[model samples]
Target: MRKALLALAITGVALLGTATPALAHNVLISSDPADSASLATGPAKVTLTFDQYVQDADVNQIAVTGPDGNQWAEGPVTVENNVISAPLRPLGPAGKYTVGYRILSADGHPVSGEIPFTLTKAGTGTPAKVDAAKASGAPAADASATSSPSGSTGIPIWVWIAGAVVLLAIGLTVALRTGREPSQEKTKQ
Candidate 1:
């Protein structure tokens, strides 16, 4: 019984040690236009800042939607450490504009949310040519899906958890077997 308990305790400590670092996802710290901001002129670029480094992945996406329900984000998105930015083609028909983003978090998860701001005045800027798929407000691929530098699928958190569980089971089995032998000998004598 004591050996079994010790095995469980060791397994618990190992699991906690390995799981702590991957538990936190990136949090949005700030933005260029700010959430719920009211602006007279549109920002040339939209920037989102996070509490941790943003993973530089092609799956990272940012979309600026105007009040007219059109995409305003122009050019490719850029990720620099903890900040993600995208150019805008200017905003038109002032009202509310939402900046939606799906970024790969530093911890390998995908963090997605929107920042809404009101455009107090309209500017003479046309929306970007919308792609049929992107217009639907869904990412091209699962942002959470990550690949390693060697082009291999990264090990997911679930796998690690499963491994830990398996290890615990094995340890418990070994401990219970060894614990039973001492009891069996005592009973035989």
Candidate 2:
């Protein structure tokens, strides 16, 4: 019985360790224009704030899509601590805009979401210039596109938890079975 209890305790500790990383994925705490906000004029930039640190990597991306489906975000996305920001070209339309972002969480997972905001009035800003290669119909290769489907770090959180559970269950079952043998021998004696 004591051996079984010890095995169970070890399993519990392993399970707890495996579960912590699952909770570490970054969540968007706030944004510059704010989600579903209606603005009188377009801002020159869009910023997103998260609940945890974000990995500052080239794989991070933010795309501001206009009502016309034009990509309005200019240059590369920048990350500083928990905040990520991207420059915006002058916005020209007077409708809804969607800010789509895929950021690398500090735990190495990719967190993606879209924030929608309405433009009450259009600004005189134009979309950023496209690269000559892209303008000429060549597809641009990017880190996000080339990345493995599992993510940057490859191993997912669920896999770790599942492995831990399986190992714990096997060990606990063996421990309980072996513990019963000693009690049975004592009774026979």
Candidate 3:
């Protein structure tokens, strides 16, 4: 019984140690347009800078929504040296442009947010036309919905706790079985 209890305690401590390092997540440090800044001209590209290195995955995305609710961001999002950026197709219908981005953190978790910037003057460029069905589709929208808050690493805390509980149960079972076998042998002697 004592051996089983000790084993379970050791397992619990090991789990806590492993979970501690995974608690830190990438945080947004700054952006190109600067959140809520009023600009005379549209930026050529949208850039997001994070405090820690971000994962360069194909899943990274950036969408610029103009006043007409049309998507203005162009090209695929690129990541380099903790920075994620996407080109713009010239902005039109200047009013408020919302920049929404979803990037994978270094630890394989998605982080997303929106930055709103006002365009002081209208641009000559036209907004990119997107199909209503495709625009409202799953891929782009799901990334933001799936992301956890800033401080959270990725998975929920309960997931870690449940994993630790399973490990403790296994350790206790093994320790008790081994301890019982030795006692049984000694009694037989």
Candidate 4:
């Protein structure tokens, strides 16, 4: 009985101690203009939505490869909700464009992938130059949603409480099991 109780206690402590919350990567769920969609005109901005929020505190860098091999995305990436986007000046000669993005997920790990879309018609706007302000600055979007989904590190308060609880449970169990039968022993003597 004692051994079984000890094993259960140990198992409980192990389970509680090795608790790793479900920290997952941000999977791209959908995108505006849809991947490889043939659009008649260019969109005002390119947006990528993810299954989980991407960390936006740190700059998320995305590369836009145009049909002409030119870059169209301007400035730093902005994230709102689970969407990461950048401004697009205009569309070039109608063709396919690929946007590649590498962003820090809420888990603090970097997640990256490439998606492409085609333009059915030509747009007559130059790939606008990145403005110095927006270029140097990240979007004024949700700071937390853009970063790792997992809250930053260092022992959480719950961890300390868990440790205390486990120790207390172990101590109480030991005391109850080992420190009993005092009256029985005295009567036997």
Candidate 5:
């Protein structure tokens, strides 16, 4: 009886834990070249990593713009697993370059942030002379679909409470059933 009570309590706790939403897209896990990295040379590419796998086609995008406000990204964004990368078009003038990205989360919302990297000396390739306005396309940078088939999970709170109550009643019945055994034993004695 005691063991059954303990088992039911453990099950209840586990179910309660599942009631809360999972951390699908809350924190920035990591980035390639790291945030605030001071590199003596300009990187050929920029990559951003997330806590979960991000899709390439739909929501993931990266845009690299120089301090001069000129967009220097070489081509379309590439996504391999959780990492997303964009090419650099001859980085120019030593300064901070902002890597702006937006990735679609597994849960269906868009997540976006900027990573700053400084170039100490100078880059071999001169900055692309493209106008900030001409580089017109603001890459969406969405990485993944935040809401999945499971994201549609919906259950009333009262239903959960009622289920818990039903389980508790069953557990109590098992615990009290032992009292009947003792009464039978007393009569036999």
Candidate 6:
């Protein structure tokens, strides 16, 4: 019984150690415009780089709000490995413009933050027309309804947990059976 318990405990510790790295979340390492930068003209597109790969999901969003509180990001956000980018319309009205984003991380959780930059000079650009639903504060419709469902590239954490349970069960069973065999031999002798 003691041997079986010991085997189970060792297996549990090993599984816990192995899962530590998989649970880490991605961290933003840098951005194209740089946070709080003063720009003479706005960038054509904004790019965010992370320490780990960004999940490719339809839920990823980047909203560039100009100094006038109007949306400037155009088209859809794109993800390529650790980098995520979104196109922008020409920037208008100089002042502080904020680039806000929410993205699905590689580990399957949503991460969000904002970057602010100052537009030193005004440009000839207009804000994208905001959808009535978005302007009204309603949840935007799922943009990738027809596309394939999004998920992690790795084997899911649940699978790992299930596997650990199976391993522990097997180890305990073997340890218990082996421990009994020696006692039975002594009784026969």
Q: Which candidate is the best by lDDT?
A: 1
List RMSD in Å for every model shown. 5.1, 4.9, 5.2, 6.9, 7.2, 5.7
Candidate 4 residue 64 C-alpha distance from true site, Å? 1.5
TM-score result, candidate 4 = 0.61
Residue pairs with backbone overlap in model 6: none
Kindly report the root-mean-square deviation of model 2 from the true structure over all alpha carbons: 4.9
| CA shift of 34, model 3, Å | 0.9
Whole-model Cα lDDT of every candidate shown, in order: 0.78, 0.77, 0.76, 0.68, 0.64, 0.77
State residue 13's C-alpha deviation in candidate 5, in Å.
Answer: 8.8
Q: Estimate each model's TM-score.
A: 0.78, 0.76, 0.71, 0.61, 0.58, 0.72
Candidate 6 runs further than 4 Å off = 1-6, 132-171, 178-181, 184-189
Which model, 3 or 4, shows the larger lDDT?
Answer: 3
lDDT of 2 by residue, 92-142 (tens): 889998887778888888777788899999888776556622332211222
Q: Which residues of candidate 2, in runs, are more than 4 Å off?
A: 130-149, 152-154, 157-189
User: 2-38 in candidate 1: lDDT tens per residue?
Assistant: 8778877887887787777677778999998999999
Q: What's the ranking of the predictions by TM-score, best on top?
A: 1, 2, 6, 3, 4, 5
- Model 4: per-residue Cα lDDT at residue 145: 38
Better-scoring candidate (TM-score), 3 or 5: 3
- Show how many residue pairs clash in every candidate, following the order shown: 0, 1, 0, 12, 19, 0
Model 5 earns a TM-score of 0.58
Q: Is candidate 2 or candidate 6 better by TM-score?
A: 2
Candidate 3 local lDDT, residue 118: 96
Can you write out model 6's per-residue Cα lDDT over 49-147, one digit (the tens) per residue? 999899998777777888888888887789999999988889999999887776777877666777889999999998888783254221122222322
- Residue pairs whose backbone atoms clash in candidate 2: 90-125
Q: Candidate 3, TM-score vs. the true structure?
A: 0.71
